[model samples]
Target: MTPTSSLKLTWSSALESGDRATDVQHKYLIEIINELAEAIETGKAGQSIRKILNLLKQYTDWHFCREELCMERRQCPAAAANKEAHKHFMRTFDAFAEEYKVSGGSEDIAMRMYKTLTDWLVMHIQKIDTNLASCPDNGCSR
Candidate 1:
C-alpha cells in the first residue's frame, strides 16, 4: 500500500544506506507500520491488530538475526551495540503490545504505539543501522 500522509511516515533519502536488501526490508517495515495505522484508523483493528503485531514481531526477529549474522561474519565493531539496540526495541514493542491487549485496543493506545514505532524506526535507521555500512564488507555482504 502507498503510504499516505495520514500514516505520518515518509521514506527519505536520509534513511538509505545504499544496501539493496537492507534498504528494501527497512522500507517494508515502514509500510507495515503504516498498514497498522491504517487498520486502526479504519476501525478494522480488533483481530487485525493482533495479526499485524505478530507479523511485525516475526519480521523483527528475522531481520535482527539476519543483520546480526552478517555483522558477526563481517566483524563489524558495532555488532554488539546493534544487537542490544534491536533487543531493546523488541522489548519496548512487546510492552506496547501487551498494553494494547490489556486496554482492549484503545484508539489512544494505538496512536501512541504508532508514534513510537514511527519515531523509533526513523531514528534507528539513521543513527544505528547506517553504521552497518562500515562493516568489513563495506555493505555487510559478508
Candidate 2:
C-alpha cells in the first residue's frame, strides 16, 4: 500500500445530511478517516491506529444513539430500518476492531478501514442519515 501521507481523503459536500449537527459529525468522521489514512501511509500508526480505532468505535456508538433518538422522536417511518442499520454497522465495526487488534494495523486493515470510513460512511450519511432530514424540525425535536 502507498504511504499514508500520499493519500488524501477529502469530504465532499454531497455527503451532507442537511442537518447541521449531523453534518458536522460526519465531517469530523471524514477528518478522522484522513488522519487514519495518513498514519497508515507514514508507518507511524502503531498504537496510534488503535487509538483511532477506539475513537471511531466510540464516535459511531454515540452518533448512532443520537440518530436513533432523532428517529424515535420524529416518529420517522424509517426508524426500524435505521436501528437495524445502526446495529449492523456496530457489529461490523466491532469485527473490524477485533481484526485490527489481531493484525496490528496492517496494510489490509488500513485499506479495510479506509473503505469503511470513506465509502461506507459516505453512503450511510447520504442515504440513511439523509432520511432524518426529511422529518419535521430536522428531527431534532425532544
Candidate 3:
C-alpha cells in the first residue's frame, strides 16, 4: 500500500517482538489506526475520529494491563518504566482528543489525529512494546 493508504499504519511481522499476546495487541492497535484512516479517506472523519479515539483509549488500557501482567509473571525489571510510558501515552492521547473536539472536529483536526496516532504507534511499538517482548516469557532473551 502507498504511504497514504492508511494501511501504512499496519503492524508488520517485522515489528513482532516474539510475544504472542503483545503481537496480538499491536495488531489491534494497527487495526484501529487503519479504521481511523479509512474513516478519513471515506469522508466520515468526524464520527470515525471519535470512534477511533475511544477504541484507542480502550485498547491502550487493555494492552498495558496485559504487558504489566507479563512483566509481573516474568519479573521483568522494566515493567515500571513501561507503565510510566503508558501513562504518558494516555495523557497525550487525552490532550489530542480534547483538542480535536474543541476544534469542532474539522477535517484538519482529523488529519492531525491520523498523523499523530500513526506516528506515535509506530514509534511506541518499535521502542517500548517491543522491549516487553524481549522479556523471558516472551522468548526473546534469557
Candidate 4:
C-alpha cells in the first residue's frame, strides 16, 4: 500500500475519552504512529523508519508517565490496572524494537511494529484510558 492509502487508517473519534488534554495527546501520538506506518508502507528508507521508531519510543514513554501521574492525581479507580497495562505495552514495544534492530532494516519488521502499535493504541485508549475520564474529580463513580 502507498503512503496516502496508509494515511486513511487514522485515529478515529471512537478512541476519544472526553478528556481534552488526554485526547489531544492521544491524537498527537496517533499521528506520529501513522507517520511511521506510512513511511513503512511506502517503502521509505531505513533511516525514516528508524527516526520514527525513536520518536515513538520517546513519546510513548513520556505520555505513559504523564497519564500515570494524572491517574494518581485524580485518584482514578483503574489506576493500578492502567499502570500495569502500560508496563506491558512498554515491554512489548521494547521487544518489537529489538526485533526491528535484529531484522537489519527489513520492511517486515516495520510492518509488524505498525500493526502491533495500532492495535495496542486503539484498544488501550478506548477500553482503558476512557475509564480515567470518568474520575474527573478524583472520585470513582463505582
Candidate 5:
C-alpha cells in the first residue's frame, strides 16, 4: 500500500467505553489496526494479511460475544442492536476474508478493508459501546 499519509488511529479517552475490560479490549483492537496500517505503509501487508485478519476476526468474535453477554446480563438497552451490529460486521468481514482468499489480497483491497474495519469499529464503539458505561454497575462486573 505504502500510502503517503498515516492510517493509524489513536487510542484516547474518546475511544474508551468507561469499562475496564471493554476499554482494554478496545485498546488492543486499536493496536491491531495500527499494526495493520504500519504493515500496509511498509508494503508488508500482502505477506501477513491472512494472519493479521484471522487474528482480528477471532478477537472481534470473542470481544463481541463477551460484550453482548455482558449487555444482556446487565440488561443494557443496546444489547439487541449491538448484537445485530456484530452479526452484520461478521458477515461483511467474512465476505472480505473470502474475497481476499480468492484474490490473494491486493493492496487496494487491503487498504479498503482496513479502512472499512477501522471506520466500523470506531463508530460502533462511540455509538454503541459507550452505552456500556451506564449499564447499572458501570463495569458490567459479575
Candidate 6:
C-alpha cells in the first residue's frame, strides 16, 4: 500500500441518518476507521492496530445497542435488518482482528480490513440504518 495515498473516510450527504446522535456516532466510526487506515498507511505495528480494533468493537457494540433499542421501541420497520447487519459487521470485524492477530498484521491484512470496514459502513448506513429516519425517535435517545 502506498502510504502517500492518504486513505481516509469522508462524511458525505448520503451518510446522513436524519438523527443527530446516530449521525454523530456514525461520524465517529468513520473517524476510527480513518485512524486505522492512517496507522496502516504509516506502517504502525500490530499492537496499535489491535488497539484501534478494540476501540471499534466497543464503540460499535454501544452504538448498535442504542440504535437497535431505539428502532425497536419506535417500531421501526428496519429494526430486524439493522440488528442483523450489525451482527454481521461484528462477526466480520472479529474475523479480521483474529486474522491480524494470527498473522501479526501485514500491510495486506491491514488494507483488506480498512477496505472492508469503509465499504461495510457506507452500505450499512445508506441501506439499513437510514431506515431509522422514519422512527419516532430517530436518534435513539436511550
> Of the pair 3 and 5, which is ahead by lDDT?
5
**On a 0 to 100 scale, what is the lDDT of residue 53 in model 1?**
92
Clashing pairs in 2: 3-41, 4-41
Alpha-carbon error at 111 in model 5, in Å? 0.1
**Candidate 4 local lDDT, 35-130, one digit each (tens):** 876687678936697788788889989888888888888878888988999999999998988887887778878877788888888898888888
Tens-digit lDDT string for candidate 6 (24-137): 899898888888977887788454888898899999999999888877877889989989999999999999989998997788898898999889999999998788777787
Off by over 4 Å in 4: 1-8, 138-142
Best by lDDT: 5
TM-score of each: 0.87, 0.84, 0.83, 0.87, 0.92, 0.90
RMSD of each: 2.1, 3.7, 3.3, 4.0, 3.3, 3.3
Per-residue lDDT of model 5, residues 1-142, tens digit only: 2333568888767777757888888888887777788889999888988889989999999999998988887788999999999999999999988988899879888888899999999999999988977777745654
Spell out the clash pairs found in candidate 3: none
Q: Candidate 2 on 18-116: residue-level lDDT in tens?
A: 567777777777777777877877776664788888888888888789878877877777788888988988888788878888876677787776777
Ten-residue stretch with the least lDDT total in model 6: 1-10
Clashes (backbone N, CA, C under 3 Å), per candidate, total 0, 2, 0, 0, 0, 0
In angstroms, the error of model 6 at 141 is 2.0
Of 1 and 3, the candidate ahead on lDDT is 1
Show model 5 residue runs off by greater than 4 Å: 1-5
Question: Which residue pairs show backbone clashes in model 1?
Answer: none
CA lDDT, every prediction? 0.80, 0.74, 0.74, 0.78, 0.85, 0.83
How accurate locally is residue 40 in candidate 4, as Cα lDDT from 0 to 100? Answer: 73
Which one is best on TM-score?
A: 5
